[model samples]
Target: MKKLILIIGLASAALTFNSCERDITSLNEDPKHPTVVPSGVLFASAEHALLDQVLSASVNRNITRFFTQQWAETVYVDESNYNMTARPIPRNHYNRMMASASAVINSPGVLSALRDARKFLEDEGVGAVKKNNNIAMIELVNVYAWANLVDTYGDIPYFGALKATAENPGNAEIPYDDAKTIYLDLIKRIDAAVAMINISEPGYSNDLIYKGDMDKWKKMGNSLKFRLAVTLADVEPALAKTYAEAAFNAGLFTDKSDNFGLQTFPSGLLSNPVYQDVIQSGRNDFLPSDVLVNFMNSKSDPRRDVWFTKVAGLYVGGSYGDENTFSDFSHFTNAISGENAQGFLLDYSEIMFLKTEAAARGFSVGGTATDLYSDAIKASMTEYGINDTTATAYIAANPFDAVNWKKSIGEQAWVAMFNKGFQAWNFTRRLDFPVFTNPAGSLVEGVPVRMFYSDQEYLLNATYVKAAAQKIGGDKVTTKIFWDKF
Candidate 1:
């Protein structure tokens, strides 16, 4: 009897083990689920969420600020040994901007999100839902992407974005399109987006950027269009005049209230990445270039105090080459304090400068070049909490030169763009006004016209990069884009 009972128990245990194994095998055979949809993550309401990540990862904060000052032609090189003559960083703002543009253009998920938004507008007739908000989001992404592409590579994959693939890939070897063509397409897209806004629909919810405000989005779309129109003043005067007139007539950003930007706080993961790094390491990698510090100092610009902090009684900044050095810098502490800083997308001052340039170029805008230029200066100072008295004095001291309109326009725009590297980089390449000298040890000589095709592209998209290089004349760092002909 005992032997029989033992045999039954052994058989039962075998059966149980087999059953468990079969179940486990069945589970393993099923396909694994994707972690989450890409659109859900990439299409967040906060426009700056992706931007912040890309900026922090690609360009160190100190480095970006230095590039801004340098490219805008606002600063001068004072350190000779450091070669303050070389390109600041090989993959500084220009490279990062190009990479980000490619990601946005190539990502299937982002393309789908944009298409869905557009379809929603068409089906819902702009008023059936919060159509305008969706349009705004689409326009924001497109505008940002277009601006980045133009600023970096000059001609880029614009109309064929998301359509280029291994099969049926038109322009897989994208030849550099004229800057004029790219700008025109951007304008058309912006107009279509603005037209979709219907005030009656439910506004955007979960909007991380504007927090469901359709009116603000409308203003932003118009303001951005105006900014783009103004950018073409030097290259395409007739089209620039037409677009500027249209944008102004359509109601462009009128004040700081109309500025489109995101305010980053210190509490969450969303805090300014630059501030986070500074606080975490207590080392500020950036030093203010003598070029920038002296420029502001020469004009007695009160913005110096607002933009930088004093250290050891000297208005010192983190020098470009002082990253690993232990030397005490003047201006701001090389230490990255966790100070709250806002990441501006498009500011009133930038818009003002654009208008100033357009007006100076004889566009039929409501303001004169001097009017727009002075307003830009005042707006910049006011934004930084600089006293009005100081702004007035600076303006008076550095009067606008009508004969040298480009010089005046470029200088003021550079100053206004203080920490905004994207704008500074674009202005520098497009206008070449502020006349920046290369930093010491730059691999490429003279102003780098185009960013070296990224290593990732070389490794993954070798064929595509090769084709693009061929079209643009060469894959070298010194290859000039079409618009660099200033």
Candidate 2:
């Protein structure tokens, strides 16, 4: 009787195993999710990732703004006083951007994917037929990312940046490439992108920057060329002139309508990064720097209201190099409020200023230096929704000084570029304008020229990072990037 009972129990267990094993294959696939995301979706993911990194409040993002004296901190005086290395800012920036770029490139046939994505929109009855427009768009975005990397860290992995493949996983530990060579390659890539875009491809669907507008992307690529060229003006003047003329011929941004950038979503993960820092984080950290506000106040700058928030019904800024109470200082304007904030990766105002400088240097930029300078200021004012009458009055009141064009152009550009701390920093560093000075005990010897590679690079890529550091005069903030001759 015991043997019979054990046999029955064993048979029951076997039946249970068979039931669990039946059709397990069907359970492995989820119908609601995708194993391979559509190419357009992948591109959108890359866009969000890049913007998030560039716009975030970490040392990687806003620290440069402080370097340019656009912002100050109330409590976190360390960042405002130039202490970016206290955190893993450099490594984090590189890693995050590389990952984002990989997300776009990993899609099989990256260039082809761009075409296919636009084609899909065409099928949806919302896009125009264009040959490889998406490819140019992808290349343009890549140029911006690489440019930022080269500007921040002098020698970074250029050729091997996204070259990792199945056969050699080790390529992920990319060797640092020469900055000058990388800049040249970037110029080539931008020109190639401009050549590939089709103006006939009227509209797009998946585009986050230019809204599938081929013309705007074309303008952006060339405008970026102008910026990169001007940056090299000090170190390689001949190369700078060659590329600057090319970009000018290609056509830089003519107005705000030609601008290409990310817009702030009202809520959710897609909300503006600065808005996240301002509202969602519930942290009172940022203040308008005294350098910025005082300068604006002195000039009666029309865009001041558009650039800053009011405190006690008045505009005020926090003193630089000092810890001030957050509530006592003015914050950013309502345009940056969580519900309606938008930030540009590049803008018309900046491009106009670039033209002003290029024309002053005797480039065939097709406009007088004074007219370009005045137009740049007006473009900035109009961008912030300031009235035309006020812009005209401001431009009239503040006449352009031909004798001191460098200082005048630099200072005015610095003012117009109120929120773009990185671009403003580059302008200030290159032109040595507006006269930024740190308090005697600031953590920097003076304005930092470049950032140190993060400790992670020293640990994992020590041989390459060390060699690159030695080549560029030690891995310190004081060491200038190759293009920063100032």
Please provide, for model 2 over 1-486, each residue's C-alpha lDDT reduced to its tens digit, 9 standing for 90 to 100: 243233323322322222222222322364533223334554554565566666666554447777788788887788777776677566666666653122222212222232223333333332334536766777787788788888888898678654433354432356889999999999999988888888887433556667678888889899999999988888888888889998998788887777666554535656777777766788887888898898888888877787777788778999887888988888887675554577777888898998888888878888899998888888888888898899999989898999988898889988877767678878887788988787555887777767777666777667888999999998888888888776
| C-alpha RMSD by candidate, in order | 11.9, 11.1
Top-scoring candidate (lDDT):
2
lDDT of 2 at 220: 88
Least accurate stretch of 10 residues (summed lDDT) in model 2?
100-109
Can you write out model 1's per-residue Cα lDDT over 226-293, one digit (the tens) per residue? 87777676667788789888988887777776666655443454566656654454543445566777
- Enumerate residue pairs that collide in model 2: none
What TM-score, over all chains together, does every model reach?
Answer: 0.77, 0.85
- Candidate 2 versus the native: TM-score? 0.85
Candidate 2 residue runs with Cα over 4 Å from true position: 1-33, 59-61, 100-131, 170-172, 202-204, 311-313
- What does the lDDT read for residue 233 in candidate 2? 85
For model 2, what is the alpha-carbon lDDT of residue 396? 90
Model 2 residue 108 distance off true place after TM-score fit, in angstroms: 18
